[model samples]
Target: MHLVYHNLRRRLLKYTWFLKFLAFLLLVSTAIFLVFKIVPLLLKFPVQLVNFLKPPQSVLRTTSGRTNFILLGMGGAGHEAPDLTDTIIFASLNPQTQDIVLISIPRDLWIPSLRAKINTTYYYGEQKQLGGGLILTKASIEEVLGQPVHYGLAINFTGFTRAIDLVGGIDITIPQTFDDFKYPIPGQEAAIPEANRYEHVHFDAGPQHLDGATALKYVRSRNAEGDQGTDFARQARQQQVLTAFKDKLFSTQTLLNPNRLLDLKQTFSAALIHDLSDAEILALVKTAFFNPPNLRSGILDTATSSGLLTHPPVSARYDYQWTLIPQDDHQLKDYVRQLLFGQ
Candidate 1:
């Protein structure tokens, strides 16, 4: 028995150096994960992409229900039509029922009040430096939807690319094969004459593993052929990419990977614009854990049966360009309410 004990102690002593090395490695990995992952907490709460940030308001109740958000996406500064609101949508969440819906608003929507595209409301606001566009967008959308929005999140094109890359990339289904012959080439390859900057990009039909650049092109390409050439097609693609990326971000693989989670958390904190306080953010985390929301989505555009119609400019009405007009604003609002609230 004494001989057996001595042998065991000798073996442990012989492996002590390796055991200490493993312990040291574990310590380093943990520290790295915490530092990078907890950056959002360390830097300060609610990282703002825009400057018009104010105290967060409570989740609003509509005649239909409570908790709605407006999400706007744009080209930001470096892309063409830097101010164009490339994507506009509303997200409504019911913490109690764990139901969430995303409703896309067409970028071509014409606002008679502004005499410009609804998407342009963001552009005009930013061009005028009206607190960087969030306030103006929220007010205009609330007027249109007849519902109050409690929060707003706007992500630019650059942000999208960065986020997709940070998550290590995303997988998507290309509904059909298509090509864009005019995708603007950037960097030093930028054409001296804007017209000469076009490049052809082809996306094959079916499932694809897309990196940030490929994903951006998939969603943003409008100068393609057949059905792929339409804004409605682009909207659908955007939603597909959005859904895929959301799943990737929330997937077990991403969630379980400490490094990816850390990068994504820090990346999105810098990329997204919102007024959610730390407590609100924590509550959201809790809600998500306790009751995961079922995501439902819809598109509002020229393609939908109850969608907007192309309105020719009328000089008398101060309409000056091509825009999509809702036949009846009140009716549209009611439809949206039913779609979002089912009430």
Candidate 2:
């Protein structure tokens, strides 16, 4: 009886070990299915998942249930003010609701802490330490917007153009016919003849396909005639191009093609600057994948009816330079808060 009892105990222990092994295999298989099969299918045919699927809250860093990122676009080498962050957009995503809000901060906005234009913060930060540009930029934006910034990404012209080209270009619709005769040719800013420095670019009001260079011009054209010449209009155009590029990037062709995705990764890796870890980056991609179609975008310009900000008159206080300042600090914060929280 004693021998039989000992033999039965040993068999029970063996059964327990087998059960553990099976559980381990099941966990791994589930992870693989989610990553390899489900994710790719969702990318190929993205549905309105926000209605049914809410992202796990612990996936990324967030403040007040909103994850915020600052996107900085620089002119890059060979262009004047290569380090200046001409395009500053504060993008906030609500994983619970999959709502995205894009707020364009003008480069000419003043930063009292740096005693300079907001655009110069990144440049000075880089001078102080490596990878400090994004840090400083994020801090400055947080101060102005009254929100915590979780991450920052800085992309130059090269990366912008190359990424678009890698995906075989993007499709954009010109909302209105416009002409930009002063589109400065790269590396020719100081050329002898001013006439030779800029080449004329025109687009009709209709659907159009744009290559890398032309798309760059479409977003960077700040000297177009009439309403299109305004910085506000340029900001709108930039957002439109960004939406188009994002759609192209996640389209079935791009998502399913391994070679194209690899090439894009290589190109972006060379030209992009960010402080995101591998896991954090994946989390953001997942957030975007499950996001809804609702996108709210606005530019904080003094000309807007909202009047959240005002153009302070040129004075020695601003070094005799034009800059935008909030009309009411409290109101500005409230405006941003409403955009993010709808409260």
Per-candidate Cα RMSD to the true structure, in Å, reads 17.9, 18.0
lDDT of 1 by residue, 287-307 (tens): 444555676654443443433
lDDT of 1 at 273: 66
Which regions of candidate 2 deviate over 4 angstroms?
1-56, 170-179, 202-209, 225-253, 290-294
* Count of clashes, each model: 0, 0
How far does residue 90 in candidate 1 sit from its true spot (Å)? 1.6
Q: Which stretch of 10 consecutive residues in model 1 shows the poorest summed lDDT?
A: 1-10
Model 2, C-alpha of 44: deviation from truth (Å): 25
The whole-model lDDT of each prediction reads: 0.61, 0.69
lDDT over C-alpha atoms for residue 296 of model 1 = 65
Clashes of 2: 0
